[model samples]
Target chain A: EDKVVQSPLSLVVHEGDTVTLNCSYEVTNFRSLLWYKQEKKAPTFLFMLTSSGIEKKSGRLSSILDKKELFSILNITATQTGDSAVYLCAVGKSNTGKLIFGQGTTLQVKP
Target chain B: DVKVTQSSRYLVKRTGEKVFLECVQDMDHENMFWYRQDPGLGLRLIYFSYDVKMKEKGDIPEGYSVSREKKERFSLILESASTNQTSMYLCASSPTVSEQYFGPGTRLTVT
Candidate 1:
């Protein structure tokens, strides 16, 4: 069975702090791993990592995947209260386009 | 930009009642997915449609049905609503098999 696990189910950080969220997966025929941020209602796309040891970044957010290790990490620098939300990780299959999602990491950035 | 929309932001249904949740995407995406979100469980896929009229069962498809009669619209049906079915339902669409865009979720409550 394919499974995705996220560590540090919940975290508390102050503004301007840097936090790293981890996600590990065990899936057959893994094609890509994706990260999302959910604030209130919807989850917005963060990044999709398909290559090992390569980093994808946008502003204060960055992510990297280790395909060889079957894990991924999302880093947020200079965290703010607006960054408080649940971060999700999902793994996709190349053949079926199916995705298996992790339990998510809830981040609370205090002002 | 891709936009995904759901029929309702909140819904209340009684046990044994039939419920329908609708999703529409404006990007003419080839893949549409339905998932339920719960505390501690993250997102569990209920069903997915790769093309018009082509539907596939996802990880958690029991007590649910799906319809994709058109390219931009997908619907999820709860045959008989139960307390266990109360959850936040999310809709997502993808161009191929990656980088999914999500919609504002519908919170369903069965009492």
Candidate 2:
């Protein structure tokens, strides 16, 4: 069965702290891995990683995938209280394009 | 910009009542998905549509049914609403299986 697992189900950090969220997946014919941030309502797309070793960055957020290890990590630097949200990881399969999501990692940035 | 819209931000339905949740995408994406988000469970796929008049069961489709009469609209039906079914329902659209744009979720409460 295809599954996605995220580590440190919840985390608390002070402002300006750097936190790393981990995601590992086991899927047949993996195509891509995606990261999303949910603040209160819907999740917003963060990054989509298809190749290993290549990092995708946006502002203070960056993510990378390691296909050989079947895992990915998202790094957030200079966190602010506004950055408190749940980070989700989803793995897409080649056959169905359907995504299997991991239980999100909730980050609470204290001021 | 891609916009996915849900019918309501919050809804209240009585137990055993029929419930409907509507989603519409403006980007003309080929795939639309319905997922239920819970506190611990990140996002569980309920149903998805690949094209007009085409639908498929997702991971958690036992208590949900979906309709995609047109390319831009997808509706989720809960035949009989139950207290346990109360959750945050999210709708998403994607051009392919890569990056998905999500709508502001609908929070449903069954009482």
Candidate 3:
């Protein structure tokens, strides 16, 4: 079965701390991997990585994919209380619009 | 900006009752998806539609049905709600087979 696994199911960090979350997948015909942040109501898009080695970044968040290892990682630097939320990772299959997601890492950023 | 909206934020229904969760997107996306999120289980795909009236079952589609009568709307139906079906139902839309935009989600409680 196509599955995505995320490590450190939960993380507690202080403000300004840096945290790295991991995601690994076993799927048929891997295409792309995506990250999302869920705060209150919905989950917002973070990044989508299709190629390996290259990294994608926004403000304080960055992510990279490793196709050879069948995994990906999302790094958040300078964490704040606002960054306390569940981070989700998903893998998409080639030619399929469907996505398989991991359990997510619930991050708690203390002030 | 792409906007996906769910009809409800929280809903309470009794077992054996029929339930409907509606999702609408403003970006005129070609794909729509329905997923259930649970603690430890992550997000499990229930169903998806690539185009209007074209539906495909995902990993878990038992006891569930979907409708996509128009381009912007997708509906998930529970013919007979059960306690196991209580979960956070998420709706998402995508332009192609890539990045997806999600809605606020609907928390369904079956009693």
lDDT: worst 10-residue window of model 3 chain A: A36-45
**Which parts of model 3 are misplaced by more than 4 Å?**
none
lDDT of 3 at B94: 95
List candidate 2 stretches off by more than 4 Å.
none
In model 2, pairs of residues that clash are: none
Model 1: lDDT of residue B39: 97
Per-residue alpha-carbon lDDT of candidate 2 for residues B40-61, written as tens digits (9 for 90 to 100): 8889999999999999999899
Question: Candidate 1 DockQ score?
Answer: 0.83
Candidate 3 per-residue C-alpha lDDT over A69-91 given as tens digits, one digit per residue, 9 for 90 to 100: 99999999999999999999999
Judging by DockQ, tell me the better candidate of 1 and 2.
Answer: 2
Q: Of the candidates shown, which would achieve the greatest DockQ relative to the real structure? A: 3
lDDT of 2 by residue, A1-111 (tens): 999999989999999999999999999889999999999978999999999999999999999999999999999999999999999999998967589999999999999
Better of 2 and 3 by DockQ: 3
Candidate order by decreasing DockQ: 3, 2, 1
Which is better, 2 or 3, measured by lDDT? 3
Backbone clashes per model, in order?
0, 0, 0
Error of 1 at B20 (Å): 0.8
